[model samples]
Target: MSLRQTVAKYFTNHAETRERHDDPALVSHYYKTTKDKAMAKLEEMFSDQQLYDLNAISKEHGEISVYTKKGRKVFIIVTVIMVRPFQTAIDFSVTSESALPFDFGHSNKIIQQLYAQIDQHFTPLDRN
Candidate 1:
């Protein structure tokens, strides 16, 4: 992560992952699965989590919205994009709900944990 990103991650209540994120771990993740399968797996995974509540799911659009059920309370959006046949890229956005204006990197931590679970659930393509 760059100096700006590293500072902002701790100073803000929101953090997101994308295709070209400066942090290698936060880069968009590619999975060896079709969109339909990926969406299904994500839905199942999120729904099965005790800390997460399935807010909404749009298989057609490939977006899943969820909220934390305990602790600091947070909103998370998971996006799955099909780059090619059997190749899907997934990203995450997390926002911490707080009046203090910052969650002290909690949002980024949420994304990292979510990504870790996703990686464990699916076969990831080459990160490079």
Candidate 2:
């Protein structure tokens, strides 16, 4: 399948529901409304080039990968950053964990940390 199709499917599959999951829509909504705003004020955000390097691939959106970590399949998704400084959202999920049994806390944390890491990597460019 094409990248766009893949991304769309992924988002649809993980769409938020009343039940609980790594709903991409819900997560995106939260980021766009809150995180995106806070990030906008920062002198440096994530640039598209940086995102591609971090993800180790070329794509306009994000990439999702699943791996076995400590005997559990962890879903690791790396999203491209459309902003400026060098930020990308990295999300992950493990079917075994339960602290956030109702939602995607772990994944969100990973994604946030990834963004911070990327943000730190870049030397802020002038804002003129």
For candidate 1, write residues 1-128 as lDDT tens digits. 67987888789898888878777767888999999998999889988879889999998899999999999999999999999898899989988999899999998788888878888878989965
> TM-score per candidate, in order?
0.94, 0.31
Q: Which ten residues in a row have the lowest lDDT in candidate 1?
A: 18-27
- Who wins the lDDT comparison? 1
The whole-model lDDT of each prediction reads 0.88, 0.34
Clashing pairs in 2: 45-84, 45-85, 45-86, 46-84, 46-85, 46-86, 46-87, 47-86, 90-111
Candidate 1 lDDT for residue 88: 93
Which segments of candidate 1 are over 4 A away from where they belong? Answer: none
Error of 2 at 109 (Å): 1.2
Off by over 4 Å in 2: 1-68, 81-104, 123-128
Candidate 2, residues 1-128: lDDT per residue as tens digits? 46764455333223211212343322421123222433333213323323321213324334333332343223444333433334223333322233433333443444445445544643323222
